[model samples]
Target: MDLTVIWAAIIALGLFMYIALDGFDLGIGIIFPFFPDDSERDLMMHSVAPVWDGNETWLVLGGAALYGAFPAVYSIVLSSLYLPISFMLVCLIFRGVSFEVRGKANRTKNLWNLSFILGSAGATFFQGVVLGAYLQGIPVKNGVFFGDAFFWVTPFSFFTGMGLLITYSLLGASFLVIKTEGDLQRRMHGLIWPLTLVLIGFILVVTLWTPMTDPHAASRWFDSPARFLLYPVPILVIVVATFMFNAMRHQHDSMAFLLTIILVFLGYIGLLFSIWPYAIPGAITLWDAAAPRSSQVFLLVGAVVIIPIIIAYTTAGYWIFRGKAEASTHY
Candidate 1:
């Protein structure tokens, strides 16, 4: 395989892993506030606590690969996405702090809960904006992300943020099904049908709007043979979503959550397929943005050593903690 292609695949795989792994944790954070009581919320938080921090390993790896393998794309994306990224990072910091402080604090479960909700919502919104901005394309010229603070501002970004908020919340709810039982499980299963509908609405609106929002992307989707092949992505999303809805309605939370996750995964793949060569979509192709092969190979050795260690530790931690979560004080 070509080095550039190989490197691109690594980046994509890393990103997919980030979404699949960190996704449910982020979903847990998003859904934290939605549960009816503090105990249920605590259960949700505990389920993710063991692996949540380690889940970020994929992000770190992806960032490293982007910097090492595709420097130019990294520069453009980071430049354009700086504000949202900063906001998201701050929310993450506060959220992580809340996790520790809540355990230590003698009182004020209310305050900690507030922190958790705000942190989750803020992080999720920023992530959505970043996705929207990436798809909509930044106003870059001659290798710059342009100057306006509003460069990333748009209606599409707004919808994207909302969509992901629902999407991840559903993911969290799905997890609740898998991890909890009794009243909590019933409530979580209650979430599936409505959330599934909302997600569908989001997809419909985005599909209609992306054309008007980014014609270049619209061209790729609306144009001939490419367009025809692309239909299956949305079809799969719909099919999986429908199946999840049925499962959830029937009280099969585990299967419901798993299938919903599969839907999101396919949607992610579709997004990647839509813009394969361009790291920044309309900005730089992977090869043009690629670093030297020697550097990538050097990093690959370190990655091989590091990634497995992280995975093993993460797996072990989860296994140690695994079971129906019961609400309690800090870890």
Candidate 2:
């Protein structure tokens, strides 16, 4: 019944939607260079073109919701993450422009190709850096940011950035397996096992590093007797990842894709469990970071109406375009 709880849920939902949805498209962009043929790359682009814009809407919604409903969180996080967030926005712009201009100018096609690839990687890396910075705990004094601008630039953050790139690449490869066929899908198949292995390594590193680096987060997982409530999460993640690996071997593209997504969702849920009740990890709880009650109620009313419509529209778009993408396919 608390407005802070309601808004926190809304913000979390929006961010999760953005990560899961836009993540694949960014992954596709990261893997664009693997295909030597421009035509194959076009097939990859076309596969995501129909839904990428809509997928990005969740990002906008998440940012807006945070700024509107939790101004304190917005101000502090934005102040701390200004440079990385700015860089991410610039990369996204280049990527979006590349998508639009690549077909129009054949001479500069290579330029656009590079733009898309770097843009995707840059955006994803910075996002991971932001995540790492938050996970490491942002410094706050009297409800304001007190950290240096370069607080996000560290070895662990860089490792997290690379981990995200690999993860996105894996997601992209899985998507290609689902949406492509013949030679392209075969190439994706070749990439899958290696990507999966690297991703497992990254996960292992994070799993080990997180608790060592942040004792508070460690306590959440280790000290709580009630944590048995989440006992099945790691088990489910392992099961899904195993199924996906097997599905990949069997060339069951759709099943592999679905399983991979489930794995990502389970990880997301695990993270939510670790960071619950806190909007800014150790620094600020959701209620402390929340806006006025009246503002939250007003926003909640609009969100209740708008969110379902967004979901329905996104579902319809995906349903209408459901099928494998071909070289000729373009949105």
If scored against the real structure, what TM-score would every candidate get? Answer: 0.93, 0.97
lDDT of 2 by residue, 232-329 (tens): 88788678778867887888877766776787777677677777768898889988888999999898899999999999999998998888997776
Index of the highest-lDDT prediction:
2
| 45 Cα displacement, candidate 1 (Å) | 1.5
lDDT of 1 by residue, 1-331 (tens): 5888887888787877777777777888777766657667777888787777887888888888888888888888888789998998999888888877776565787788778778878888888999998888777778667767777888889789989888888778887788889988898888878888898788778878877766667777777466777788877877887787679768984798688768787777667766766777777777777888898788778878887887788789878877777677356
* Decoy 1 TM-score against native: 0.93
RMSD of each: 1.9, 1.3
Residue pair clashes in candidate 1: none
Candidate 1 local Cα displacement, residue 112, angstroms: 1.6
For model 1, the superposed segments whose C-alpha errors exceed 4 Å read 224-226
Task: Candidate 2: give the clashing pairs.
Answer: none
